[model samples]
Target: MKYLLQGFTMGLAYVAPIGLQNLFVINTALVQKRSRAVITAMIVIFFDITLALACFLGVGAIMEKSKILELGILLVGSIIVIYIGYGLIRSKGVMEKTADVNIPLKKVITTACVVTWFNPQAIIDGSMMLGAFRASLLPEEGVNFIIGVMSASATWFLGLTLFLSIFKSKFTDNILTWINRVCGVVIVLYGIKLLYSFIEIVKGY
Candidate 1:
């Protein structure tokens, strides 16, 4: 129970941030049908689970022990994040009439995977935060902790998609455009922060 609570809290806190993952999910919910949005959420959840497990196992150790590898990951992730953000910022305004445009499942899954996996910030968070916590736990406790984290991810994505689906009609096209702009700016700022952090880390070496 204690481990469960700890994992749930930590996982919720980590996932609650308004990052690229959330933004991508939100956009999908807005544009796609409920079924499609749910599919995207599931893919995101899968990545979350996979990453959480990876960190809990031993991948985090590998990352921590290799400064060059960590730096490389950070650099690549930051650049990709910046590029995605730039594209979002420059995208045309969302049109309600086009909201139902049929996007292929392959494209949706691919995009979700890229966004979830390619983001360095997400990798760092899982590895550093969850990894440290997992290291301090008993093996059984670690299992419970991971379960708690997975539950959080599942709950968050499902709830977010449902909420967006329910209130989607209330939001005007202009409102969605503003949302896109705001989310884009936030992502860009986050990318810049990641880059800056990388530079600082490099300076120490």
Candidate 2:
């Protein structure tokens, strides 16, 4: 019980940050159909679970020891994130009233995967925080902790989607456009921050 609570609290804290993954999910929910948004949410949750498990199972140790790997990930991930943010900022308007902006399922899934997996912050959170937490638990307690983390992730995504679905009608088209612009700016800033961090790491070597 204690381990479960600890894991849940930590997971929520990590996931609650407004990063690329969360922004992607929220944008999907706001622009796409409810069904499509749900699918995207599921993909995000799937990756979250996979990452948490990998970290808890010692992938974090490998990542920590490999500066080259970390640098490569940060470089590519920052570029991808920044590119996506630029696209968002360049878009003319929101598709809130129409399905014109609805992209194919494959593209949605692919983007979600990229945003979730290639996010440097997400990688660090899963590897450092989750791994460190797992290291503190007994073998038997590990499963409970994992379950708690997964539960928190599932709850957060679902709640986010649900909230968006309910309030989506309240947002005007201009408001939606502004929201997109704001999210894009934030994402781009995060990408730039990741790039700067990567450069700092490289300089140390």
Candidate 3:
């Protein structure tokens, strides 16, 4: 129970940040239908849990040990995150309506995977955070801890979707555009942080 509560709080703090996953999920909820939004959130949750489990298990430990691997991921991920942010900021045609966007379910699935699975910063951070926690716990508490993490993911994403759906009437096109712009700026800042981490790592070598 101690581990369970700890995991839940840590997971919430980790997932609450406005990173790529949150941006994608929020965008989906804003422009997509309620049903589609729920589906997208669910898909994101699935990939998120998968990544979290991998980090908790051992994948993160591998990265922690491999300086070269960590450096490569940090550099590449920083560049990609910055590029996405730039694109989001400068794009004139924000996805204003579901009718205009109409992203396919298959595409959504692929994107969910990409945003969660292939995200370098997420992988590194999750490993650093969850992996450390895993090491500190009693071996038998692993299940409880991970279950707490999974529950937090479900709660946050689903709650976000529902919140957006209920008040979606208030998000006009202009407001949505500004929200995207702000999110883009935040993402770019996050990328710069990752780049700084990469530099700090290289300095140690």
Candidate 4:
């Protein structure tokens, strides 16, 4: 229980920031039907949990041993992330009776995967934070601790979905469009940062 609570709190802190994952979830909830938004959140939660597990389980170590592999991932992920941001920036943000023009499921899944697993910030931060915590845990406590973390991810995403749905009416097309543009800018900046990191790594070798 102690480990669980600790993980829960840590997890909340880890994911609470207004990054790609949160922005994606928020936009979906704000623009889509409740059922579709819920589904989107569920997909995001699955990827978030898996990504957290990968980070906590020494995937970062494997990448660290191969600079080429790490650089390749960062480069590819950055391009994709930047492209996603461009799409968001171009989106019309039409919400209301016509809000049913939903994104395809496959696209949603792909976007969620990219924003969670392929996101450089999520990768670097999760690896540093959760990986360090993993190193300090007793073998027996690992499961509970991670479960707690996963629980936090679920709660936060689902809660955000619920909250936005409740107040979704408050958002106008203009407001949603502005939100999209802002989030797009942030995501593009993240991609640019990752690209810059890739160049920095190249400089070292």
The most accurate candidate by lDDT is 4
TM-score of each: 0.63, 0.61, 0.64, 0.63
Clashes of 4: 0
Candidate 1 residue lDDT tens string, 116-142 = 888887786566555545434567887
Decide which is better by lDDT, 1 or 2: 1
lDDT of candidate 3 over 1-205, digit per residue (tens): 8778756865765575556787788788877789999999999999999999988888435655776765776677677657656765764434334332258889889989998999987887677556545533456676788888899899989998899888976645575456556656765665676678678768878
Query: For residues 124-199, what per-residue lDDT tens digits would candidate 4 score against the true structure?
Result: 7676556545544565676788899999999999997898899876756677576567757665665676577667
Task: State candidate 2's TM-score.
Answer: 0.61
lDDT of each: 0.70, 0.67, 0.73, 0.74
66 Cα displacement, candidate 4 (Å): 17
Predicted model with the maximum TM-score: 3
Worst 10 residues of 3 by lDDT: 92-101
TM-score comparison, 1 vs 2, better candidate: 1
Which residue runs of candidate 1 sit more than 4 Å off their true CA positions?
59-102, 169-205
lDDT of 2 by residue, 1-205 (tens): 9778756755654564456677777778888778888888898889887777876677435545665655665676567657656765765444333323267878877777778788776676466445544433456787788888888888888887878877976645575466556656665665676577667777877
Clashing pairs in 4: none
151 in model 1: Cα distance from truth in Å? 0.7
